[model samples]
Target: MSASDIRAEARRVLGICDACGYCNGFCDLFEAARRRSALTDADLAHLANLCHACRNCFQACQYAPPHVFAVNVPRTLARMRHQSYLDHVWPQTFAPLLNHPVATVIGVTLGAILLLFALVLAFAPAGGGLAIETGATAGAFYRVLPWTLMVGLGVLPLGWSALAIGLGWRRYWGLTRPRRATTGEARRRWCAWRTTLADILNLRNLRGGGVGCNDLDARFSPWRRWLHQTLLGGLGLSFAATLAATFYHHGLGLQAPYPLLSPPVLLGTLGGIALMIASLGLGWLEWRTAPEPIASESRRLDQAFLGLLLAVAGSGLALLLWRATPAMASLLVVHLGTVLAFFMLLPYSKFVHAGYRAIALRCESLDPVSID
Candidate 1:
């Protein structure tokens, strides 16, 4: 599309942004402005940067008073995304799936099924016995516990990786099928990648710093971006801890009930708790004070996803506090299941915003002037 079209679309989106903000206070971007008594073009730029296009704000706005502005931030930020691409800072590599609606749904569905199967088998007792004969030491009830885990967790994840790799290869560089994307679609796909990076990773378009009540506390000091940095730190630490534990136990022959102070268990618990709080608190603010009548329009999918996340955190905490075996295992499984659901249902959920935001940022870098 030409710059004129992009501008018209953007203005239309801005109108939606304003309307939603007016009714719902969902537009934290403008909320920040309202708090500071200043909403300038510069603030808009800052807001743009902070916007990962998660659509939570927009979704909340849709549920707001004036439904006129269904400003799909993803499309609204396309112009900036167009610019990010030329800068070679795209977050995700995109292809036909960027535009292929059916592909996204199917891919996510298959992924979920693959994982669920693993979970079922892992949980289920073996065909003939509760205790499958293992070549391990005597008194080791090792037969069922870890073996089930290996087949269910380890094997299934492997299958998922294989499926993704094979499908990606066949779809992109495969021998059987070659993609045929029109030039216009191709450009948009590239734009998607750009926006995904800038909007999601960098969160370049959050609308504002924070409302008055939140601003003073949200210090943008050299230490960090409140939600962003805390989140990243937590995720990084948690993932590392998970990997370490998985390797030591699953790979090198260690066991569960690793000391609570163990690296992986402790770190993962800490990280998980921190992320749980950050995600829940910030996300709650997004929904709760989400600008009145607008907030009511929250979608089931978004609510369910975030709620699932909250539940996972709660379950983890419960495990620690109560330390009930059945409850702990069940909650852990639920946490795993929800996380699996997230990845499996990825393309179909708002979480897709993460990848798309990065892509959008790259697109913006490619052509800012071209947008208008």
Candidate 2:
């Protein structure tokens, strides 16, 4: 019915969460934290970045809690993603990125170019003037074509994300209070930017990671956790590499034809593949083994989000298959469309959790600090 009702239902009924480390073994965030010395608020925040939103924990935690809680970890995480819009985080840094509109816009635009830069380089020689023309040498096309992409596809979305952060940071939209907004909206609006950002990014409040603060208790399958983390970590690495390669090749004038097979290139390629595979794999697991069905009100949106992902991955695979330079550009065009649609619609879509979970966790971090 109302939002609070939904949250209550989630923590009490729908969420099959147990405070088990079963999911820990499989979770990448957890793995990264473990690999390091002590898990900090920064560490928890990083964990949020890598979560796959797969409900494998739901299936695995069946017997841990006596009653199923209604809390949706994924959804909450999505809400916390608002923190990212407020401040642009690279997801892995876990540390705070002082909110910067220029950096946000530039970083994302560069990322888009970087993603397809390699293909562009491969086509550059074909275009003759280091600019990829339609039917030029693969080198010409590879180097030049990405500019068309960077110009035609990349700039708009990056510009928007930067705009949202810039505008939203100033409280333009946030100031327009909801008529009958609930406490949640109030908290979201009035919450101190830094504190809330920390909480949302850190995800210290989440009960699942282990703690008696919240009722959520569940054991998750290690296999699913690993799959989710591997994909997330890999993708984050891929994104970073994309930026590095672009700077090296474009800015420094080095010969780095990308989007082809090599060590790191192969790894980036593998990361994208892992994302698709993991998405499908976890989707299958959810269909086969969810603890309970989501409310009908939420089901359609949920399915739509899932369907979009399937399309993103499917389109990507199609591009890889048709990598015959000419087709690669078109395939890239399709990717830009889907991904842009995906990011722009984040707030309204089920994907919002991708942003929010860590902030909640960060709030959790403050409690212990106060207790001591």
Candidate 3:
């Protein structure tokens, strides 16, 4: 559907919901909706992001599917959430990538891999074959891909993605946040930040009014919430591992290929395993989930982003396992390529939902009437 159509549909569904008020206790989205007699485009955007797609309302909704009203809150909000990503993505030139996620992700990843291969072949020392065996020594990774070149390759794209994400977040906030300051706006915002952070860390809304999300059918399940927590935990550990590696390199003069028991290696290994498991599980859940609660158009985007996560984690683990072999150079290139592709696609992918949702949660928290 076109952008206008989506907004119009969202307005219609939310208007029905606001009038019904039956699902008000299900989530903050409803509470926020209660405060608005008529939802504006900005209000719809905020409500869309605030929805966690828990499917509780869809299952409980009296006017759902066979009824005349045919209210499907989860699916409607899912589509709107996806649209919000497209609408707010920075550097509008890349916005189209979000539409064809599978193609964009696969094409970008392959391009990065090929580019890395070309760079390796061109920069390798004279008389060396395509494969350079750099043993299991410290700093061996640098032999295949120089430290400076590798850092540059990783940093440039990452920096650009960060800037893009920050700008996109700013745009979303500008649209959703209150235009005028209240008497105690600063204090209210501070409280909202803390509340939103707690909600994010715990995947609070996924609880679906205490039972859990309706993942597969009408039955409430905690699997989705657990998988999300695992994914976030794995990402945290992986980031921590990176930080530790940096400290070891710059602070202690230690280098790459730390021992299995070392902080970086141990933490990265665990994180990689957790990421692989969570990504695979979440992908499976998405595939097996009932069609009613899902936005069919969003499957490709969700799967594409999950595939990238799996690729990065799996490749990193493989590189660690084979660092001593002649395959290390190729594996390093693959791992780095996947990492580069992930960073480049992140701002334009389903990842943006996290930032947008956080903002929505904060906005909900700042509402004058408590949702508790």
Candidate 4:
């Protein structure tokens, strides 16, 4: 459907939902909807982000399929949420990547790996073995891939991704941020920030009206919530590990190949294991989920994001295991390539949902009715 049709459909469904009021207690989205007499594109986008796709309302909906109304809130909002991502995307040129995310992700990953392989073949010493076996010395990693080259590879993509995501966040805020003037605006915003952070950290909405997400079947299950928490936690730890490594390298004048007991190594190891498990589990859940409640268009994008996480986590763990072996150099190249692709595509992929959702949650908390 065209963008206008999608918005029109969403408005129709939400209008019915507002009149019914059966789902007001299901999620914060319903409350937000109740307050809106008419939904603009911006309001629809905000509501889309507010929905966690828990499918609770879908299951409880009496006007669902087989009925004349055929109200399918989850599916409609899912499409709208995706459209919002495209609408607010930074640089505008990258929006097309969202249309074929899986292909884009795979192509970028393979291209990076191939380029890394070519660089290795062209630059490594003539007699260096397949492993490019740099001894387990302080600067062994740099021996295979120079520190300068590694820094360039990591920094450039990450810097661009940050800029893109930041700009997109700004645009979304401009579109959906609450405009009502109120007394104690600063205090209310501070409270909203705190409430939103707590909600995001715990994924309060995924609880599906105090039970759990109806992820795979009609039955409520905590599996989705657990997997989401694990993924978010794992990513957090992994980022923390990177920051720790940076501190050790630049602040303390220490090099990598840090001891197993060191903060970076320990954090990264735990994070990698969690990421692998969560990525695999989430993929399985997605595969088994009932198709009726999801946006068909988003399946590829979801899978592509999960695949990138799995590749990064799996390759990093493999590199750590085989760092001293003949496979170390090959694994290193694959790991770095996957990381590069992940960062480069992050802003254009499902990863942007986290930022958008956080903003939505904060906006919801800012509503007068939401305050305790």
Query: What lDDT score is found at residue 265 in candidate 4?
Result: 88
Q: Write the per-residue lDDT of candidate 3 for residues 1-372, one digit (tens) a residue.
A: 888888888888888987898988877778787776567778888889989999999999999999998898888888888888888999988889999999998999999999998888877655332466655778777777777888899899999999999999999998888655556578777887799899998888999888999988999999999998899989999999999999999999998978889999999999999999899999999999999878876778889999999999999999888888988888988999999999899898888888998888887777634222
Report the error of model 4 at residue 61, Å. Answer: 0.9
At residue 82, candidate 4 shows an lDDT of 89
TM-score of each: 0.51, 0.51, 0.95, 0.95
| C-alpha lDDT of candidate 2 relative to the true structure | 0.44
lDDT of 2 by residue, 1-372 (tens): 443443343333222332334556433333333433333323333433444444444445444334444344444433233333333323324212222322333354346546555545554444332222332223433344545654555567656655544443333222211223235554544544556464443433332343211112244344444444554665576576567666756786654344465443565566567767766765665455443422332344444555555556566567556555566555655565566555544433444444334332333232222110
Best to worst by lDDT, what's the order? 4, 3, 1, 2
Best candidate per lDDT, number? 4
> Which runs in model 3 stand beyond 4 Å of their true positions?
126-130, 183-187, 368-372
TM-score of 3: 0.95
Q: How many backbone clashes does candidate 2 have?
A: 66
lDDT of each: 0.44, 0.44, 0.86, 0.88
Instruction: Identify the runs in model 1 with alpha carbons over 4 angstroms from their true place.
Output: 1-202, 207-225, 292-300, 321-332
